[model samples]
Target: MTAIGFVTRTTHGGFSGELNLLPICAHIDIVPNRDKSGDTSPDFRIFTQGVEVGSGRILSGESRGTDYVSLSLAAPGLGVRKLCANLGRTVGLNGDGSFFLIWNSVD
Candidate 1:
């Protein structure tokens, strides 16, 4: 049987900030909890290639009696100078979760 390995990362200092994540163009954020689900879906106002330039739910399941999930966004549409990406996520359910977003440029 193949064993699965888990990994967790922790960042510190000025290395963490919204600007560092989405420094240009897009306004990435978590779906506010106050807004009831099914009433409203996430809004990625910027659209490209006939696609919304965002990703769908990457995960969905229950953990520790709580629902765990995430969402993401793709790059290439933003027209950035470098080949980069923007990704966002929401954990738990009903938008009561936290967000992890990043705008990365790869050269």
Candidate 2:
């Protein structure tokens, strides 16, 4: 299994916030944008324990060289941070920072 690490921040009491280490399994599908002509546009479908939990697309960063993916969780009742942690554990991607993707590998 491969790991993909992401940084998560949770706000508390309307003033304080905590930064947490989050990771996700690499059993993901990078679906190319069919509407477009090339494979440059991709959408990520993230899975945990062989079940899909979230999907996201890469977004252009407000600043140069700062692109990020915006995830939309569909695992009912799970916050973004919790979902990240759970997905990481389920697919054995619990690491730090960002993870490398090994294509054509099975989890």
Highest-TM-score candidate: 2
TM-score of each: 0.28, 0.36
lDDT against the true structure, each candidate: 0.33, 0.36
Task: Specify the poorest-scoring 10-residue window by lDDT in model 1.
Answer: 1-10
After superposition, the stretches of candidate 1 with alpha carbons farther than 4 Å from their true spots are 1-25, 29-51, 61-65, 77-107
For residues 1-107, write the lDDT of model 1, one tens digit per residue: 11111112223101111323334443333222333366245422323334444433323345545433233445665354432333333355224223444334344
Distance (Å) between predicted and true CA of 46, model 1? 8.2
- lDDT of model 2 at position 32: 28
Return the TM-score for candidate 2, rounded to 2 decimals: 0.36
CA lDDT for candidate 2: 0.36
Clashing pairs in 2: none
Candidate 2 residue runs with Cα over 4 Å from true position: 1-42, 77-107
